[model samples]
Target: MTPQRWVYLRKLLSGFPSFPSSFSSCRPRVFSSSQSAADNMAEEAKKLAAYSAVDNNVQNNHVVGVGSGSTVVYAVDRLAERVRQEKLNIVCVPTSFQARQLILKHGLMLSDLERHPELDVAIDGADEVDSELTLIKGGGGCLTQEKIVAGCSKFFVVIADYRKDSDALGQQWKKGVPIEVIPMAYVPVSMTIAKHFGGEVSLRMAVSKAGPVVTDNSNFILDWKFEHTHNWKEVNTAIKMIPGVVETGLFVNMAQQAYFGMEDGSVKVRKAPVN
Candidate 1:
């Protein structure tokens, strides 16, 4: 779907009753303010700080893209605090409905990529990150817009807990790389992914519902698990050549850097050379 049509589809989905009210409201009782949950969240918050340490470049009127995921909640909170304390004026873009809500709740100015074609920076979370900085994202089903914003940004900063870091992209995120595809093309796409990519491929099924997982863009998700990835760029190019593929989770050479928050609250930063 076109980006404009995807936005419209998200608006329509937002009106649906089945969609959870908010991330907080959807959480299970077990995680509600429990000591373990709080500690984990605190560590995640620290990770977010490490992620946002990118030079804000405030003079240029930064246009930032925020992504969706449990870990990214901390990044939103930190950004909100920064906005309040520094009185920073910036245009914030979102990769999902949840992200847009975060932008509003944090009092950051909302912007559409259509209005701002270029983005200064984007801070987001990944399902997994390899030593080379290739990533597996879209576990939250926002990969399409996330890729758009990350691709458009001058720098993309990824934030995650230590568990997400891996020697290779598919190792940590064993659920597989999430690929957004046209609903009708799922079978062909899955077959191609398996035959050519030499991976296990499956249509992501909704755990709560009986059908396939539907993305905010009204697309189906295919989770492809490759035992090892030799060339992420080649994998990305191959997937894009498939007619059904909308976007893939493999973020090859797109990230400028990453920050991983350890369980003990220490943050580690990794940087790539500027081209």
Candidate 2:
């Protein structure tokens, strides 16, 4: 797709119904003092717009993949609106616990990934995204399932705010790339990340609990901080080669398009070049 067309498509895809219409009456108003709240509203609007654009292009009864994270909350809301409006008949599949909650709370019908092996579209959020549309995901600890859903879907749409788009993936998200691994592999993985990968890595510890952070799948999480990432594909491949590594946050060539909300109340979309 041409760059101009990509932007146009993004605006259309991210278009969503207003909050009060999709979500229930309990929808929280944008807090005047909270930047996060405002950002969330903008993000949600962009996500809805993106969903609408894609929904119109597809036939009825498409199975959709819903991803985890705060931004994807809006995506779920949009999907629910589509269902409520009867504009679409779709079986929604979730990537994690939070995603499931959004589906349930929004009153959308849910389906299992096992039941619907082929998904038409998957909507998700990224921790960071490079210019080429490569992403660093899993910040909410749902990378494994998110990747699974995205891999199975014919189109993967990522929704994020302006902060997520970057010159490079690692440069935008400084919290480090979240890596899910077997609990027993934490120490070994940490060693490899530091020695072989030449970066500072640390086990993510739960502030509320004494042990390391536990993922939705009962695995442990490691946050690896690389001072410089010259080759993201190589780094991602190397991490995947390690034993006991369940999944890395690095999402290379998975997204077909992205919608980012600007501070000025406008939304921008970017589409990957057609192969």
Off by over 4 Å in 2: 1-59
TM-score of each: 0.81, 0.81
Q: Encode model 1's per-residue lDDT on 1-275: one tens digit a residue.
A: 35643453444344334535566664554333344444544465455544455334232368888888877777777677777777777788899999999889878899998999898888888888888788889988889989998998888888887778898776767898899999999999999988887879999999998999899899999988887766889889889899999999989889878888754445677775455
| Cα-based lDDT for every prediction | 0.78, 0.78
Q: What's the CA RMSD for each of the models?
A: 12.1, 8.8
User: How well does candidate 2 score on lDDT at residue 90?
Assistant: 73
lDDT per residue for candidate 2 within 1-275, as digits (tens), equals: 45644454445435433455565553443222244544555555566545654454334688888888877776676667767787677788999988888888987779987899999888888888888898988777899999999999998988887778897767779988889999999899889888887878888888888988899899998998888865877888899889889999988888988888765556778887666
Error of 2 at 250 (Å): 0.3
